[model samples]
Each structure stands twice: as C-alpha cells, then as structure tokens.
Target: MTFFLLRFIFACLLLPCLWTTASAEAVSFPELGSAVPGHGDVTYLDLARMVIPDLAADKDGFFRGSIPIEMRHIAGPDYDGSPPATSGLSSGDVLNIKAGGKDRLAMLLDLGDSPDSAEGYAVLALYDITGKPALLDAVNVAVDRSTYFRDPGKLSIGPGDDVIITTSTHFNSSQGYVIAPLVMVRNDRFELIDMIYTFDENLCTNRRTQNVAFQAIADSQLYAAIKVTVTDATVPGDESCDGQPPPEASSRDISVTYHWDKNASRYVKDSDALDRLADDNAKRF
Candidate 1:
C-alpha cells in the first residue's frame, strides 16, 4: 500500500512539468528582437491576440457591422527611422476607410525574420465595420526596410469599391521600383485581383525611360501608361582597334497602356489605345 501511494505522488509531480513544456512549445508568436524594422516590438500574432476578443461579441452575430474599436497610424509614416540601426520601430497607422460603401479598417504590419533566418514578410489586414477582420494579403518583402504602406490617402478606391495598395521592396534604392496590388473584399473574404510593377532604369539593351502613370477614367476604370526603350548594340566586325569604339547603339521607343476590366476582374493590356498615343506623339514631333 505504501509503495502504490508513493508512485501516485511521483506521477502527480511530473504532470505539471510536462504541461508547462507543452504550453511553451505551443507558442506561435515570435520572440521580441528577433527581426528588424519590426512593428514597434509587437508581432502580428500579438496584435491578433489583442484584437481577437473584439472580433466577436456575445449578443451580436460575430462582428455586428460596427467600426473596429481601435485605429491608428493612418495617413502617416508606416515606420519611423532606419532598420538594424534603430532598436524599436514604430508600428504604422491604422485607419477606417469606406469600401463598397461599407466601412473597413486597414492596417500594415512588418513580420520580422527569424533569428537565424533572413526571410521576412509584410502583412496587410482589412477589418470589417462589424469588428471582424480578415487578412487581405501578405507579401514576401524585406522587413528591415520601410516597405509598408505609408499614406492612407494613397489607397485608390475603384468604381466597384476595390482597394488598390502600393508597396515596394527597396533592394535597389536607385531603381525606385514599386509593386501595386489590387485587393477585393467580399463576404468577409479578401481576394487579390492583380499586381502592377513600376520602375525606372537604364540597362545596357533595355530601359524603362519614364515613370508609370495612373489616371482615373469615367467608367470607374483605372488607366496606366508605361514607356520603355530598347536598343540593338551590334558590332559590324569582331576585330576592333585599340582606340576605336563599337558601333553606336540603335534604339526604339514603345509605350504600353493597361485598363481595368470589371468583367475580367483584373487589368488588361490595351494595344489600340497605345497605338493611338504613339500616333499622336508622332504628329506632334
């Protein structure tokens, strides 16, 4: 009888230790100070925990169609100061915007890379006015740099109330390239329609000579124009003299236009419009 009693006491002592170990392993949020350009020492998982309670209510059906309780960082810089050099990065602004005539909250987050890994990602979330939030999109972008959305006003609202957000990876500062993705939210679900790349660079044989431009059309359509120049650099003779240079490069200019297609739910290339623009330029010259 004494032996069985002692065994029961030992089993009770081991149970708590095992439970503690299992809880530690189950933690999903990354530890603080692991990644750069982080969201002011807060992880997206952390934010999700803090806001999950508000996402549902006892009396209402899930969200209840009311604006989220908290919003900040909207119409302001996403993060303050440089990465690595700065210890604490400020979380960007969160704002409430109307999409499809419905109020929604938009926010940006920087999920820093793992301690031993260099990979990181950026997250954009849109919360319905009813307090329910959905992750609109997440991209594989650098966390150490200021790549999150900075201006709340820059979010372009489409005719159907689709939201267009502009983000970039600053791997090459001189190129100043950006990627704009259009997001559609419906029935508490987020969908990505398309992505547009814009940049200006002078390469050896090809160049993006002009910055991409956007215009709003009458039918709730968005228009974009991009200019590129390509050159043929070929030498007539393989043997070259010491003081002589190769043949001068021959170049040609081309312009492309894109229009949002509501039926297709994405942007499509418009060759006819591009040709017309080219003809107009030719007449002016």
Candidate 2:
C-alpha cells in the first residue's frame, strides 16, 4: 500500500512538469516578441507564425503553404506580386488596421531575398482578431526599389468607412513616388479595388517637381472620391543628382479626381489623368 501511494505522488509531480512544458510551447499574441531565429533573438516571421498557426517556413526556408485561392482571384491576373515558387520565406512588416469596427492585424510578408526593405516581392496577410487570431484573407503586393510599399500609412475614404488604404512609396535617387491602393471589406471578405492614386516628383535638374496634395471627399452617405491637386515648383538639385540637364518650363497646375463606383465594386480611374501620367512615365523614367 505504501509503495502504491509513493508511486501516485511521483506521477502527480511529473505530470505538472510535463504540463508546464507543453504550455510553454503554445504561442500567443504576447509571445510574438519572444525569441525566434533571425533578427536579434526574435523575428517578424515568428510574429506571423504566432498570429497564423498554419503559416510556417519549410526546412528549405520557403513558406510551407500557399495563399487562399479566393484572394488570388481578387488580386486578378494582371497583379504581378504573386508568390514565386523559388522565393524563400523572409521577414515582414506588421501593422494594425480597422475592419468591421474591430482591430485587425496586417502583415506584409517579404517573400524575396531582401527581408525587410522596399525591394523584393511581398504578400499582404490580414487577420481578424475579434476573438482568436484567424486569417481573414491574403494577397500578393508588388514591391520594387523604385516602386514598392514602404512605411505604409493607414487612411479612411470617409467617416466610419471600412475601407483601408495602403501606401507604396520609393525614392529612386532623384524622384519620389507614392501609390495608394484601396482595400475594402465586402461580402464577408476583403477586396482590393481595381483603381489607385499616384503621386510622383522628380529632381529639379531636368524638370520641375510637382507638389501634390490628396484629400478624401465624402460625396454622399455611400459614395466617396479622392481629389488630387498638383502644382509645379522648381527645386534645386543636390550633388547627388549629377546630371545638370537643361531646365524645362513648368505647366499650369492641374486637379484630378477618382470616384468610387459602388456598382462596379471598385474605384473608377480618371482616364485623362492616368493616360498623362503613363505617358510621362514612358517618356521620362
């Protein structure tokens, strides 16, 4: 009888130790800051895995799974940020955004050789945190040194709007670029609008830099528009800009607008403004 009692006591002691060890293995939101593998003791990838239990990197360093098919469809065929088969898993950027009147986690996962920069490919992962962290949706976002998402900011189209805007920015030695995309929640899922607003300013060596201002105007209870006003100014070029090309004359200031078409489920692009911008890009950089 004494032997059985002692054995029971030993088993009880061992079980608590085992339980503690198991509990330590379970990850939570707070543990995202804990030690992982790369980038000091912890990495942004570790935070991603903590938030997304199914997302993991393989032995070869690539992600173990693919993004949801529905998100891919929403991104459309022309979207070039699709995950490559050869790109390995790397660090990412994490931020908070509002969706459904609650806080949601947004992660721009880097899927390129460059881990935490404006260069290389990336995938946007959104998670619903109303309860447990659950992946709401994900999509590939384009990234390049001259044109990539850098220090993305949050914006709302109108008062109490569920739409979120993400900015992509780059400084290509002589010019600065900003591209903002509208992400909205519709039909129980996140959707990417087909239109975008852009701003670019070049160095003063060859041409005058354009100063642009963006404003969100609520047209009505259900519709909104983005107003872009552009004015030109001659900025002095620094030593970094080696080419002292002939100065070009400045043109009159222009105002452009893009409207959200609810029926089309996307924002309608300003054709004239878009064509002019495209032509300038083709002719210049």
Candidate 3:
C-alpha cells in the first residue's frame, strides 16, 4: 500500500509537467527564410505578417494581426496588442533608409486613433537587410490613418544622410495639416530627432482662410533650418457660410524660422514662431 501511494503521487506531478511541455510545443510562430531569396519573392507585408502575432484572415479575406508582448515596446507601454486594420498596409507602408552604413527597411503599421485624441499612432520597425533580415528595434510614433512615409531624398546631416517620415492629417473637409518627423540611425538603432509641424491650412470660415508652408534647408553640416511662411485673408466675393455677413476683407502675411537644437534633440522655433504656433493651437483646440 505504501509503494502504491508513492507511485500515484509521482505520477500526478509528472503528468502536469508533461502537459505543460505539450502545450508549449503546440504553439508555434511563423519563421522567416534563413536567407532572403529575392526582393520580389518576399515583401514588407510578408515580413510584417511574420513579426506580428496571431495573424488571421477576416471574413472579407483581409489579413488581421496583433502586437506581441515582446514587441510591445515598439508600439508603446500602454498598447495591449490592439490589432490594426490590415487594409491600412499598402505599397507605401515600407520605406528604405540607411542604417549602420548599410541599407535597412523601415516598416510602418498603423495602430488607428490614439486613446486620448483623434490623432492616430503607428509602430515603426527597422529591419537590418545585411545578411538574414532581422528586426533591430521598433518605436511608437504618432500618425494619421491616411499618413504616408517619404524619403525626402538625402540630407547632409550628422555623419551620414538622414531620413524624414512625414504624416498628414485632414482635420475637417476644409482644414488640413502636415508634420515632418526626422529620424536618424545611430548606435545601431533608429532615433527620432524631431517632429516638425511644417504645413497647415484652413478654408473659409468665421476665421480668415489661411495657408502655412515650410521648407527645410540644410544650412549647416550639423542640422537643418526650417523656413515658414503664412498667408491669410478674408474673401470678398465668396459666401461660404449660410446667410452670414462676411467679415471685412483683410489680409496678412507672416514668416518664421526654426532652428535645430542639438542639445534639445529637436527643432526649436523662434519666439515669434512659438507664439504663432501657440495661437494656432489655441484656436484649433
């Protein structure tokens, strides 16, 4: 009887361990090729699908995927595997950027609207394409549903060329804005240097119709200076509002410049520019 009781206790402990091992073995993740065959065979979408967790096809046949815990750092601390709409991924979702004196691919996945505002967010992953394509690191970034990435060609900044990722937002049928984010490769990782609100515009309303534009010039070897111009006027012949008297016809022009601050790791606008931005934000919100 003593021998039989000992055997039963041992069996119970061993069974749980066996069950845990089997469960772990049952779960598997998609694997990438040991070597990249060719660019045509594999795409950023395929690579994204491999990295993203719990990939499945929706009823409409579009792919759906979730962020994994290991990649949570790329999305943000508060992001909890919220699946982005697969339709958001397009030919423009991936961009080529230079990293570590070699070519790298930057993949952007839209995460939809942020919890705090109507502004959307996204996760950017840098893949080292030297040997076997592998993810270097990822970062959570702010963007819009219709946001797109641009190379901006090359700029003479830092030790090598820098890349600018731009996102645009349409506030309403009549209002829109654009932001340009500068990202650089350093220490084997991609760092966000700054996000510049480069353009904004608003159509006919109680306020004057306005248009703002910015052009970045690499004035120095270390950084770039952004030149901004603003123009606004009240239309005389246009009746955009229903039965409302048009405001007095008036016009104004403003110009401001912003410089890159190395210490602050961002672009710093002059006092006049800062005030203008603050006033604009005050009016928008």
Candidate 4:
C-alpha cells in the first residue's frame, strides 16, 4: 500500500511538469514559416519573406520583387494567413515617420494584378523604441497610373510631426489624373481630413476639365501649394459644336496652410485663409 501511495504521489507531481513541457513547446505556425527566436523585432521585409518564401532580395539586401498572388488578402482581413498587399521595398514604397514621439512605418502595397495600374491599399505599422510592432491603421487608397511608372506614392512628415501621404488616381469625370484624398496620421490613427482637388466636367459641354497639382511646403507652418488648371475642350473647326465656345481655359493657384488644433489634437485647415484663397481664385478665372 505504501508503494502504491508513493507511486500516486509521484504521478501527481509529474502531471504539472508534463503540462509545463507541453505549454513550452514552441508554437508552430505553418503560415509564418520556420520558427525563429526573438521575432518581436522582425521588420516588414522579414515578415514579407516569411509569408512569401519565394521572394527575392536585391543587391542592396532589400526585397524588390513582386509578391505571389496566393499570399494576398483578397476576400477579407486575414492578416495571419495573408498580408493584404505587396510592396517594392527598394522603390520608396515604404516610409518611416515620427509621430506622437514614436516611430511609425508605412507602406504602400500593390493590391492589383496589373503592373500598369497602381491599385493598392496602405498599412501604417507602429513600432516602439524596443522594436515591438503594432498595426496603427490601414486604408484603401485610389490607384494611380503614375505609380505604375514610378513609386507608388509619397509619404512625408507634415506639420507637428504628422504623417502626410500623397497619391494620384483617375476620376472618370475628370478624364485625367486627380489628387487622391490627402491622408494624415493624427493621434496614432489615419484620418482623411483634407479635401482632394478634382475636375468637374458638367460645367461645360465641350468636356472642359480641371486638374490640380500639389506640393507640400513646410516652413514655420505646413502649407500646400495647389495649382488648378482648367482646360477647355478644343473643338475642330469642321465639327459641329453645341454651346457657346466653352469658357477659355484658365489656371489658378492657391496656398493652404494647416494648423494643429491642440484641443482636438489634430490638424485643421485655416478656414478663413482657404475661403479667401478660393474667392481670389474664383475671381481670377
């Protein structure tokens, strides 16, 4: 009976150790590739390669090749199984910024199959001083043809250390490239706080169109120089035309300044100055 009692006690003691051993067994994630220690500091490229084992690296040790289609998040948000987009790390498709006194990384990902179309979404991932990563935000930006020919978009640090992202996309009515909605990272989140410059085709019968060009001007204050060009449709002398010879093509320039509203903890446009600029531009053209 004493031997049996000792055996029972020994088995009970071993139960906890067995449970601990099982618990300590490294978690196996087939999708994330081989298990590696100290994975907390993995960069975007590291994660990309894990998800896409066939990815190739460039001469500069950067991954610049396209991603496999099977690794994309096509239907829903399955971040564990597949990343939503792909990026060319060597082509300025990734941006690092500082916001709220923390390091933030953003990447423009290609979501479409057509290499000629810059149709993709964006992800802003935040990391701490220790390099622990977290997803700050994600957004779907309009595709721009220019991106296919060059880098996907431009990301910069705006006034008050805010993140500014610029992209170009096609507007059907505009019939040309128009600036996508300006995205700003404020309060650790992505916010579309500014209006985009677009063309209105209904104003004239000859299909007069307008296009806006923008540049970020940073000094003591954050400013954007927006140049708007209105192009009147040219009617052939032999073709029959409808309404009054469409208004003459004209161009207007405006400067918009942004201010950080402490109360809201976000950047707000200078309404009075914007109104004045709009009025002046309206009178000019």
| TM-score between candidate 4 and the true structure | 0.45
Candidate 1, residue 76: the lDDT equals 24
Lowest-sum lDDT 10-residue window in model 4: 19-28
For candidate 3, lDDT tens digit of each residue in 1-285? 332253234334223212122232121122232223355466455566545655545665445565532444322354333434332322224555555456666666555544554445566677776666677776655544334343232233433444444443434454445444556666557665545453333445344444444456777625667555555555654456676665677877666666777788656666575356546755764
lDDT of 4 by residue, 65-177 (tens): 44543422212343223233454443224544556556565544433334333444433333332354545455444333322111222333443353344444443432433
Each model's lDDT comes to 0.37, 0.49, 0.49, 0.40
* Runs in model 3 lying further than 4 Å from the true structure: 1-41, 56-61, 68-92, 114-117, 143-145, 150-159, 177-179, 197-216, 224-237, 240-275
Model 2 clash tally, residue pairs: 0
The Cα error of candidate 2 at residue 94, in Å, is: 2.8
**Highest TM-score, which number?**
3
Worst 10 residues of 3 by lDDT: 19-28
The TM-scores, one per candidate, come to: 0.43, 0.60, 0.60, 0.45
Candidate 4 residue-wise lDDT at 126: 31
Residue-by-residue lDDT tens digits, candidate 2, 1-285: 342253234334223212122232122222233443233644545446643435666775545434423335235655544343443333445555555556666766544423343444455677665544466677655434222222223445654344544444455555555444556765436677633434445554443554444466778635468665555455444434455554545555556777887787567756577447545654655
Model 2 alpha-carbon drift over 4 Å, by segment: 1-47, 50-75, 81-91, 113-119, 143-152, 167-178, 194-204, 207-212, 230-233, 236-245, 248-253, 269-271
Per-residue error for 126 in candidate 2, Å, reads 1.2
User: Candidate 1: misplaced stretches above 4 Å?
Assistant: 1-89, 114-119, 130-146, 150-162, 173-175, 201-210, 220-267, 271-285
- Tens-place lDDT per residue, model 1, 1-285, is 342253234334223212122232121223322321223554333343333223222342212111222322221234222212112223333444556667655555443332332423334556543433344432233333333442231333453353434343333422333344444455544555444443334433333322333333344454222212212122233444565544453433343445567788655665554345335433522
